[model samples]
Target: MSRRSSRRSPAITSTSPCPCGLGETLGETLGECCGPLHAGSTTAATAERLMRSRYSAFAVADEAYLLRTWHPSTRPARVELDPAVRWTRLEVLGSTGGGALHAEGTVEFRAHLTDAGRADVLHERSRFTRVDGQWVYLDAL
Candidate 1:
């Protein structure tokens, strides 16, 4: 197995609320943060939570989590989250906005994965939204 995502600073603050924007409480987010593995984060803790959860969704093949955390309009009901893929690491390039109560935000991230023992990359520019006091992932480019 690869190094745990916790190798760095304990990704999520055991006390801060998650930044996935899924209308879930701190307790709920904590469960996810401590469970299944995901990608690493840099800079802000909220951004880390978002990145880590996305990785967890991928690791566990939790299509629902992926969709639920995803901003509705641009999100799909179901996706074939590949199970054979093994994610290596995540590099958060940059993040902007999405602060305060309700607003829009964007996160640019680089995800590295290994498929069939071959390395691959997913460089995406993702969008996010804070609705009803929750941050939900929108879509990625």
Candidate 2:
């Protein structure tokens, strides 16, 4: 197992609401509703799922998982999570492709966040690619 897996944080509980606003209780604390993805399972089955998991990663400050799932072509050497920012909600506006047979996909979303008591929203259309049978975040479009 990798160091990331070994150091999995125990902050999230099984009954906690997913930070991505998936409306599902985290059955296991693996990724707080995206456990399978963060646990090194196969790529998310859909673009929306990948998007949600990524949002949850930001919410929980899982920089390792974010980097692991990012496409190598565009992935940065390091990811820095802002402790002062608190992610509040996620709204998946739409998605295209990103299925069992597709190699590429796009997900549009708006994430609500608060930083230093100031509320804000982040909107973007993200691209994704399947690499070696796993979904990886490419970039924002």
Candidate 3:
């Protein structure tokens, strides 16, 4: 396994409620809640769902998942996450496209986090695209 896989934190469990606050219980493992994106079993059906899973990936420090769901054209070979940063909450502002019939979409949201005893919020509008039938993050707008 790579360092990123080896460092996969065990902070979240399957039974734990989704960190994205979607009021849905996780599956048998952290990958279950977002298994489609993580395991490639199926692509996220909607842009909003993709965005939620991405947020959950950050909360768990699953760099692998983040990379897997990222568009290859813009995806980096590897990702380095700040261990000190704790993603606390996600508030989705809105979304467009990335639906059953659309191949592209955009999701806007705010992510709340705390790092080194400092709390901060990240607001962004993210773009997504369908690559080989999977919705992958393209970039921030």
Model 1, runs deviating above 4 Å: 1-48
Candidate 3, residue 10: CA error in Å? 3.6
Kindly list the per-residue Cα lDDT of model 1 for residues 1-141, writing each as its tens digit: 223322322434433343333314445553445333232232123534555577555644555556656667887656664445766666677877755533777778777877878999989888777655556777775
Between 1 and 2, whose TM-score is larger?
A: 2
- Give per-residue lDDT, candidate 1, residue 118: 91
TM-score of candidate 1 against the unseen true structure: 0.63
The reply for model 2, stretches above 4 Å from the true place, is: 1-14, 25-32
* lDDT of every predicted structure (CA atoms): 0.56, 0.77, 0.79
List residue ranges in candidate 3 displaced over 4 A.
1-7, 24-32
TM-score of each: 0.63, 0.83, 0.86
Alpha carbon lDDT at 120, candidate 2: 98
Colliding pairs, model 2:
none
Residues 36-63 of candidate 3 have per-residue lDDT tens digits of 4655676678888888888978887778
What is the C-alpha RMSD, rounded to one decimal, of candidate 1?
Answer: 9.7
Distance (Å) between predicted and true CA of 86, model 3? 0.4
TM-score leaderboard ranking: 3, 2, 1
